[model samples]
Target chain A: MGSLDTRRLIVCRHGERCDFCFSTHRFHWLDKAIDEAGRYQPFNLNLPRNLPKRRGGYDSFRHDTPLTEMGYLQAKLIGRAFRDREIKPHHVFVSPSLRCIQTAIGILKGMNENHTKLHIEPGLFEWMRFCRNVAPSWLTVDECLAAGYPVYQDYIPVVKETELNMNESLIDFYDRSHLVSKTLLSRYPTGNLLFVAHGATLDTCTRQLCGEAPRSNEEFFEIVQKTPYLSSIEARQTGAEQFEIIGTPVPPLAHSANAAYDSQYLTTPGYANNTDTL
Target chain B: MGSLDTRRLIVCRHGERCDFCFSTHRFHWLDKAIDEAGRYQPFNLNLPRNLPKRRGGYDSFRHDTPLTEMGYLQAKLIGRAFRDREIKPHHVFVSPSLRCIQTAIGILKGMNENHTKLHIEPGLFEWMRFCRNVAPSWLTVDECLAAGYPVYQDYIPVVKETELNMNESLIDFYDRSHLVSKTLLSRYPTGNLLFVAHGATLDTCTRQLCGEAPRSNEEFFEIVQKTPYLSSIEARQTGAEQFEIIGTPVPPLAHSANAAYDSQYLTTPGYANNTDTL
Candidate 1:
């Protein structure tokens, strides 16, 4: 094999705040609704509010938002996991989104690997959430019922509407997100590949790779079972033409009491149990 | 207009260097071929072949690859131009490509503009030129004939081959380049917009805005002529949702040639032209 041939694909979803700290913050209720409906049923629902008063609307402030405290720990765990396994990546592929970029930077920092080349691709951005300040609220119980119950089956449709209302869609996000991994795989085939992406993108990408039926965003998180973290799919390139998924592993973290303390500050609570105490 | 609307788009191409300087020096003959043909055509053609050697390649040496003396001068010119026009951009978009990035930094250095929010978007990258080490002399006249004539019509095919042979393509480049502008436009409708991009992307974008057919890579330089160092396109958002191209204007230099020389290096032809003179 050529010295430059890529050997392994190391995939990592970007850390957590990206999921919770959207522009409108109104999506918190929507996320809660989905979480309450259980992980199997998908349901579409409109956001109760219009655009947040942010600059980029929902997508604004992406560049300045840092990883939450939980996010930092998640990255550190992934870095340690790689170190424990003695894995060294030749190149790093990252989403330009602030959360993913920060996660990639943090993971590398934790591992003390400073010199790897990081290529930021926009295709890895998270699914778009349409936010309008004027979006009508579901004030009455009947209005809530008309809005439809949040079912796992309705997740895709709801996310699609959210994107459309916001002028950005999950399908488009998935399509573009896949391009990020595809570009990385095609360009740097045999290397430990790490993709710091949003939860929705990571969910969609993993399902596509794992060949599962479309999963709701909530169920997608269940596949990894960690909040504000990284998930890995170990794939071996058999030749220049093929890739074989060898294992999908979510590295275990050393539980600490502080984990719970950090979780309390997140915009969304109860997503994960934080047994760790300060 | 909304208080946050982007009133203008400031587009500028990267600075100058010889092909050898950009790692593209090996294709001097191809550049020469295009330039020769451009003289007879209505459009201008001034492609710089400043390709740098592969990073860490055996032949790579510690030669100074910093911006040239002309490049610095060009950057200052752009800065002064912005200042003179009293242009203040809310957002600055830059191509992640080295030359364009450096150019953006240089120009920003001279202006009073805030640099805290500059974004390096990879989507704004120029047309990709794959390196093929084969000598032009080795190819026969017949091979040149097989490659087709040096008209704008034939340029895209050859450029495509050059990129594909090296795993890059103009089509992908054009699409990606356009994505940067589109993304920025969606977010910043009425602020002053600054884009530091490649000559090719700027050219294609300029042509597209002017309602011309997509020009070939060689012809791109024609539509967007290069200045002594800097070239610019000024555009304004009009009619609520449309952008109207103003004009391509060159930035004025702050210091005259004599004053600039007096302020900096001791002027001499060889020394002034030497990139290492810095």
Candidate 2:
């Protein structure tokens, strides 16, 4: 058995999502891509090349969007960096969101670790306040398996999706995340644990595990807003049932956004005509 | 010889640039990443994994920066899309900018076209107004070759770097690009040609060939601003020397900007302490 001191936990945010980045007040790719005849066509390169079949149909993407191309790439790069640095996670747990599942897949592909399967933990999902007091219609374990994701077929989650407190306060959210973290850590008891979820998971899941107090709503929002996609935090086991928050194992990924190119600009008349050259 | 109807020309903008995306007025990665000892270390994932050596040393990145991680991926994806669609470019020409050269390399890699080499052309560069009346210290063809780029070392440029009109107006920019376009198409009249350069190259190089007038500064700027990274335009030969500007063969790439994550928020106090859960 590995020493308890070596046991570590990593919490990471999912990569860029299509809805938050591409959708406007009046239009969204999810709505525009699907034809009345049920044909799906992606209009932009940053959008997902394909989407997995969902129980709620394509409309479910409004609540649970997939990662953009760069989003997947960001997660994959982080995985490659971890592989190069020899930081291996023995067990992987991810939020039930499609973006989170895709991110976990990208990381595993990057690390070239085909053997490790992901545990789809609804307990690891983002704050319910952001979800508007309702559980996101996430894909089931069977659905995820059919989608070719390396999900553990038999691993049961500590906190089921239906049991999530959609009306939970900030304090309740912290307790729930802390409970999940503790349950998973205690259950495994050895090797490293990696969590691929939302921005707040980096804090909520490990904050109480490190014996830190829960943050207020304003504080929690501030942390979530500051956390960019694929940002991660690491925690090391310091004592019995205790962990200390360590710095990230890799440098945080950063890049400016790419704007959608408008074809109209090619012929849009602005001001004046061709002038003579010097 | 291929039919005149089958001959094609594609003009493309380079991928996301490191300097334009990551640098602020106060601090630039080129200066910050290099220590006083001249050891180069990338502080972020979006910055180039490694930089090619230059005659002006690491400081040269100020004028010629490499592509961000997503930038390279965007170009590669476009290449893959083109390859999938069987849109093969028999010859490729690239601007002297590091980003443009790197983009060409990415596209070639994606298309699995190892036999083709890039012809670095200074004439295809963006407007001199943006260059501030001075030539950017670009990597020599030999320097690029030494850096493992597949460059056509023996191909003499139609317009040398020193010949670029640093003080030229928008009309001059269009005319220069037009001359280069006409010269290249006339010289190699059989196969398709692909030019990877700046956002404006999609217009400046092909507009005149299509019998369109030079765009005014206002008009040119509008087009340039709307042209996202890896944006492309195609032109096909019509009669003898005449060509018609066709629309893009692939979907325009798009995504939102990624903000840099600050670690301070993790520990920074916001408001109040942990309250009892509901």
Best candidate according to TM-score: 2
Q: Which stretches of candidate 1 lie over 4 Å from their true place?
A: A1-278, B1-6, B18-65, B130-171, B209-212, B216-218, B224-228, B249-278
Residue A247 in candidate 2, Cα distance off native in Å? 2.8
Best by lDDT: 2
lDDT of 1 by residue, B1-278 (tens): 33434477667766554232323334332333234433311110112213333333212212212244345435655675567556766667665444565577667765755443446554555544522433111112233234331112121111222222333465565555554566566666556778887555554444444343454555444333322235566666664545556655432221111001110111111232333210
Cα lDDT tens digits for candidate 2, B103-200? 99999887888888999998888787888765678999889989999998888887888898778888899999998999998888789999999989
Interface RMSD of each: 29.3, 6.6
Model 2 ranges off by over 4 Å: A271-278, B271-278
Clash list (residue pairs), candidate 2: A257-B256, A257-B257
Taking all chains together, each candidate's TM-score versus the true structure is 0.32, 0.93
User: What is candidate 2's CA lDDT for residue A50?
Assistant: 86
